[model samples]
Target chain A: MIGIVGGLGPYGGLDITKKIIDETAARSDQEHLPLLLFSCPNLISDRTAYLLDKSNVNPGKAIAAILRQLEMAGATIAAIPSNTAHAEPIFSVVQDERARMGSTLKLLHIVYETVRFVDENYPDTTVGILSTAGEQICSLYREAFIRKGFVVVEPEGSQQEKVNNAIYDEDYGIKAQPVPIANKAREDLLLVMDDLKKKGAQVIILGCAELPLAIPERDYNGMIVIDPNRILARALVHSLAPDKLKPL
Target chain B: MIGIVGGLGPYGGLDITKKIIDETAARSDQEHLPLLLFSCPNLISDRTAYLLDKSNVNPGKAIAAILRQLEMAGATIAAIPSNTAHAEPIFSVVQDERARMGSTLKLLHIVYETVRFVDENYPDTTVGILSTAGEQICSLYREAFIRKGFVVVEPEGSQQEKVNNAIYDEDYGIKAQPVPIANKAREDLLLVMDDLKKKGAQVIILGCAELPLAIPERDYNGMIVIDPNRILARALVHSLAPDKLKPL
Candidate 1:
């Protein structure tokens, strides 16, 4: 059973859980249906907190509370889908919760799973990353991929701004009308991808979740594009049932 | 710091770790170099073990020993690259190691991060998976993605055989030269991919680590491809330092 510590962003948590269920492989009789438990608390947003430099409500406790609930409900393994919540202090609360749960439940790290997937599948591939300026400049994908022997590519100055605008613009997630600013952001990603391809990038990773919304799979050229959420789902299934996953 | 628990397959472990470093984001001032710890305990090969089922090896203990070493070396976080080693008993050993390490270290699951990356980036899309019969018949990705709302597709019988042959055929990984059997596997994957595209799959996921070797991005059609290992590397970067990863 899988318990999802989510709701950092309503859509992201739900999307990740759904991906896990959708991508997991099932046997003829014993299908892998993870019991999902979600918690979406009204915590301060990471974007607003980071940009404004204000005291933001930490969602870690809320995440822990949700995990406890999942444990009670028979969830054996748990994972949080929010990337920002992985900060040391925030994850500490989660660790504490797992400790309290006493070995029955496993708390899975979202980022580690993502990096492991890449290493196992795309050894020596040069990859272009599209992510928040925070994720890009701080050495998120850059640090791990470089260590693993993959080449990490990023968009330059103005193009990065375009990507940022697409994510933070108020009209970005309106869900009805298409915003011109967001469209420009999508176009900017294409330009970056093209440049990366020219530089011999075999794969382009959408480092930020929001970036995938701007550049759908259909728009990409022949380059392989990786979205971490899907990879994590497959990993979860494997973790939950390794013996059942033996190949023929 | 990220500690890789590798060498499960000798060179494959080194190869995976190298890929993570190479693909991660880095800068002039800050570098994302992880603390890597490896243990290569020789054992009967996975292919042989699966085929003969006569090995007296304990993959769980091997992984547990590595985790213990990483924690003692002061690794705050850890991940394992071997897919088959994720069985429950093996992971249980890992959990025990975390507990013994004063519970300060976090063991990251590769599948969880992969799902989170996809959910963050690609919200509503259809994805096709190419993996070992173990992964596919076991329903590793299918259940997870379905829960997340992404459509999951798999190859049929003969295609599955082709994929398996491509990876395990004596001429491929074991031999220096390319073989006709390996080419047949690649061709079969392409045919399955075309079928998936016709069935509305927007992205094709190379779920099995070996499948990436069978299909190259250049030869693929315009569809987006996902390599799980690369996604895992990016996710690890995000896990280690979320705040530092800002776009320039």
Candidate 2:
């Protein structure tokens, strides 16, 4: 059974689950994958806050505990859908915790799989990204794409801050209001995409799971929106039953 | 945390979760309810087959075990979102299992809450239902509405068989093809509904959660369609915090 480490702000889990639903080529419900969604949002700390040092509490420990629950509940393979949660400060501790447990559950690397997708399909293309301030400033995703021999583009100057505010704004931020996402969030993302386009970016990856909800899959405003959620979903299908996975 | 006893057929869990998302009066992610969906479909047997006595395995024992897992996972209140799951043959065993374990988890009776809603809003009106043969033929729901002083209507003869096949045809049934639900399921339900309208039925309860996905909410061909999943979502919010519930 597949396990989802959800509640990393809640909606990412739902997003990836829906993507998995679409990814599976099934003629019946029994053919659809059996999975468990352990969305204990209260147990998990905010990933962006921990990475930003706004909070000393690292979310990885709680995330590790959730995975243990999923493992105990019969999930052989699991994935955490949040991009920010993949940072050094958080993911390092998650690795430490899992090592201590000797877990048999295979935790898929959301960013690693995504970078591989780009390397294979959009090779030699200029890649751009939109993510939380923590991920961009930490260079977690940028370095991944750079190592793949791809020139990574980022929002320059105050445009970076604008994108961050659009994601973190207390009242209208995606974190503050995930569903019925603020109109400004979409408008701000589109505005940033225009900047990336001007920079000669061939593909813009929605590095954050939350960003994809406001942005479309594949093409948005003629710019390629590479949703890691969709990649992670396909990776999940590939993990257990490769033949059951639909063609890309 | 609210625990959902999902995996009765898998899609029902997704259905109820989405409804809860819609029923929530949240402008932000934190305001949304924290939920755990434990969907182990392979662990449980077919409810319809058990009800028909074609299978000796009772689903309640597995259902009761799932609730225990939910309770241990820190769920204060839990619910099983299947109508047929509440039948005497299954629900009685569920209660026995719970009593034996001394579980504190609250399993919301889907049919009971639904009957209460019908009694309060559409009083004195004939009620029509579309559900799995297990729920209908067993008189599990019929007796409840009868006790509430309402005449219950069901599909006649072959129409009832058609409704059952649409939900469990193995090839085109809802249990088999929940996503991109088979068109025959919707067509079969509409045809049966037309007959109910001719029978002086005032409110048509989408008694089965699967049926609600194929049928429109509130109105279907000008007939009042009562969605139990919507009502159950409201009930969940009311159990936790009534003020948080979006008005009806």
Candidate 3:
């Protein structure tokens, strides 16, 4: 069974969970895929905070524990939907924990899959990155795209603030209370996507799962919004049932 | 941690998971509750089919197995969101499984909690029941309400067909495909609510979780539509946390 190590922002995890069902070629309720979710929202430290500031406690150990818990819960392979949490430190922790437990719970690399999608489809097109401050600080998206031989454009400092506000603002942030989606946040996020388009970006990557809660699946402005959540779900489907991989 | 025994139907499981997040009073993601969800959608047989036909395979044993898996996954309390699957035989299976395992994973009763809400808030008011034919045939809602000293009213035969259509029809049924909520099904289900109001239903219980996907949570013809999903979420919240029960 596919396992989800979620609650890295509850809405982001829930978004992936819902998308898995939407990604399946299920006509009946019974046709959907089986998913085991360990949604421990309270356990892990804040991803952006830990990555942004040295004083903040790192969530690597906590994430590792959760992954082990998912493995114990009968998850053959797992995906953590938090974009910022995919740093080298956290990935190392996951690998170490799996090795120690002798568990074969494979971790789906969301960024790798997203970069591959860009490499295969967009090829030489310039990609714009819109994600958390932590993701930017850690250079996760920048490094991934650079390795794929793709030009990456980031929002200007002022525009980046708007993106952060759309994701972390108390009143309207997608990660803020009363979530899943918000209209005002969606409109604000659209403005950021528009800004990215003006910077010669042909494809935009919603590197963070929380971003998609504000941004719709339809093309952002005219640029294609590559949601990591959908990409991860598709990758998961292909991993579990390769033969059934034909446009879920 | 609260464990959700889901995939009785995928959307029904997702609905409850999203509601738990929505009902929480967390200002940040860290304050939300931890939820472990085991959503093996294909594992169990169809609830309606089995209950309505003796020839059909019973899902009781399969559900019990899923619950056992949830218990193994470290869920202290559990809830299954399928309304029709709340029959006596199912409950007995759950109890029997827990007994055999010597586990204390308490199962929350959605139907009982919903009836109690009506009994406490709209006492002595005539209540309308809109649900699957399985629920109606089993007299789940009617029996629950009558025992609580409240008058119960079901749809007329012709209107019942519309209710069933909204729930089972492929293009628009809540459980059919492409779910959560549907517009045309919502409009059709609202018409049934209007009929219930005409028959002196002071309050309406969305007896099935899928029904709410078709019917919006608003007063229908001056009647309060009591959503069992929301009721079940509230009940779950209370069971997990009695001290935090102010307003969600």
Candidate 4:
């Protein structure tokens, strides 16, 4: 069984689960992958808040706690869909906590998987990342792309601030609005994506979980939208239930 | 925390989760309810097959087992979204198992709660139920409606078969297809609804989880489509954290 460490913002967590279902070439309900999603939204604090030192609570312990529950419920492999949550402090603490508990649940690294997927498929491409300030400030995707010998570009200056508000603004952010998403959030994201496209971005990555919901389509006016959620989902399918996975 | 006993069919399980998110009047991600969904699609056998004596294995045992795990995971209230799973044998088995183990997990009765909602609002209404062979054969909703002094109606003969196919047929069934559903399944369901409308169905009850997915809108060409999943979600919110629930 695959464990989804969800509620890294509720819909964002479910985005991975939805993609898993979509990516799997299931002929019947039974043909789909068996996964458990633990989405205790209130239990885990904001990843960005913790990363930015706006909050003292490390969400890693709470996330690791949920991972432990998933394992207890029979998850053999697990994945956390949030890019911001994959920062070194939060991600490493979760790993260390799990290791201390001797957890055998193999947690798939979302950044590593996305970088590897890009290396094999779209090698040497200038990758544009649109994510929360947490992932950008942590340099999570940048470090991974550098290791993979690929150029990385992100929203610059006030454009980056617009990207953050598209995710974090209390009034019109993706997380604040209902599932169809707010017009302001979508517009802000589109403007930033256009900026990235002009910055010589051949490939675009939705590094934040909530961004994919805003830009649901993969084509995105020919920028080759790469959702790390779907990439992580493919990684999960390949790890254990390879046959259920569809050809990309 | 709420536990969702999911994978009665993966998408059906997710429909309730989606509804919960929709029904909650939350401003941001943290404001959304904390819920866990365990969707082990292959673990439990088909509910209809077992109900029809085509299989000896009772999915009740497996469902009950999952409920126990949900309790351990810190779910105070729980719900199974499938209509057929609420048929006496399976529903009671889960309750009995929880009782035998001294479990405090509150399992919401989707059918009963739905009927009560109808009774309180749409009093003396003639309800039309669209469900699987298991629910129809078991008379689960029929019994519940009868107890509430409400008139009940269902698709008769060939139309009933079409409804079943919309839910269970291997080719174009809702369970067999991916999200967005099959055109055939949706067409079949809309035809059945037309038939039900002709039969004097004042209120339409989407008794099966998958039916709600097909006919998502509550106001289906004027008939009030009573989605039990949404009703169940509201019941969960009401039982605890009533503040989060949007007024129905």
- Please report, in order, the local distance difference test score of every candidate based on alpha carbons: 0.60, 0.82, 0.78, 0.84
Docking class of 1: incorrect
DockQ-based CAPRI category assigned to the predicted complex of candidate 3: high
TM-score of chain B of each: 0.81, 0.91, 0.90, 0.91
Candidate 4 ranges beyond 4 A from true positions: A135-138, A169-172, A182-184, B99-102, B135-138, B168-188
Q: In angstroms, how far off is A29's CA in candidate 1? A: 33
Which model scores highest in lDDT? 4
Model 1 residue runs over 4 Å out of place are A1-248, B28-30, B43-53, B100-102, B133-138, B172-182, B216-219, B243-248
Q: Residue-wise lDDT of candidate 2 within A1-248, one digit each (tens)? A: 89998877566777787778779886644577878888777678777777667899988999999999999988899999888788877899999999999988999988899999889888999988887746443387788889888988889778887788777898877767767899998788889988998888889988766687677657866667798889999999889788889998
DockQ for each of the predicted structures, in order?
A: 0.02, 0.40, 0.85, 0.68
> Per-residue alpha-carbon lDDT of model 2 for B1-248, expressed as tens digits?
78888877676777787777678786545577888888776678888778888999999999999899889878888888888788888889999999999998887888888888888877999988887746453386788999989998889789989888888798888767867889988788889999999997888988776677677658777678898878887788789877888975
The docking quality of candidate 4, as DockQ, is 0.68
Error of 4 at B206 (Å): 0.7
Name the regions of candidate 3 deviating beyond 4 angstroms.
A54-56, A135-138, A176-184, A246-248, B54-56, B135-138, B177-184, B246-248
- Residue A247 lDDT in candidate 4: 95
Instruction: Tell me the TM-score of each prediction against the true structure.
Output: 0.45, 0.83, 0.93, 0.91
- lDDT tens readout by residue for model 3, B1-248: 88888897887888898888777777667888889889997888887776667646767777878888777777778888888778876667767766887877888888888888888778999999887747543387789889888888888788888888887888877667444566767887888888888889989988777676666665767898888878787777778876544483
What lDDT score goes with residue A235 in model 3? Answer: 84
Model 4, C-alpha of A191: deviation from truth (Å) = 4.2
lDDT string, candidate 4, A4-103, tens digits? 9888777777778888877888765667788899888888888888878899999999999999989998899999988878888888889889999899
- Please provide, for model 1 over B19-74, each residue's C-alpha lDDT reduced to its tens digit, 9 standing for 90 to 100: 55445554320243433434233321242244235565545655666566556645
